[model samples]
Target: MKVNIRKWNGVAIWSWDVPKEEVCGICRASFDTTCSSCKFPGDQCPLVLGVCTHRFHTHCIEKWLEVETSKNLCPMCRQWFQEKTDDGDGGTGAHANTNVHSSDVVSTT
Candidate 1:
């Protein structure tokens, strides 16, 4: 049997490697979804994993850190929030602005 095709379409789907039941510590939204401040998911609302091992939506954590009372602490563990770096050095500091993205994250899955 022989087959010939002239037209073709392809669809692809992608998702964060986080567990389905896990939610952002700050926004309480799943890692696969955007935070309340974001209109859509993906880079616009990337997930940030803190040195304390708590995860939050980028916008959520950014907003929280901006508040004077937040004291740059992880909303979940109350530890100083720092963007876990690639070197596994814990991170620089809460205000370091690591600019990390989900795609750049080392998969913990």
Candidate 2:
């Protein structure tokens, strides 16, 4: 099922929270431009894509997906996170939470 802006917005509103932005993956610089639709924090994790293509401030994904029982993945690519892994292990990083199946959540796209 596709989760439209209204739905995500409602969810965020029901929870009394807002989207996060500003913060780079490597340099910790404030993010000024990011596609809210396809870019998110996990997208900015130093553990992801190596070089950041997003500007989610690191808090957006952290606040939304970070949980003890929950494993956070890139909402955009649905790929596992990793800073720099060479031992393989599915290419997951040291801080990677776990694999998140795209079939599990409402599609934001």
What is the C-alpha lDDT profile of model 2 across 1-109, one tens digit per residue? 9865754333322211223453444344444443243254333432223212332334445553566443654454544433344346654444443557979779779
For candidate 2, report its TM-score: 0.26
TM-score of each: 0.75, 0.26
Clashing pairs in 1: none
Please list the C-alpha lDDT of all candidates, in the order they appear: 0.82, 0.42
Deviation of model 2 at 90, angstroms: 22
Which numbered prediction scores highest in TM-score against the true structure? 1
What does candidate 1's lDDT look like per residue over 1-109, in tens digits?
9999999999978888788999997778888888889888887888888877777888899999999999988888888888775564445445455577888989778
How many clashing pairs per prediction, in order? 0, 5
What lDDT does model 1 reach?
Answer: 0.82
How much RMSD separates candidate 2 from the native structure?
17.4
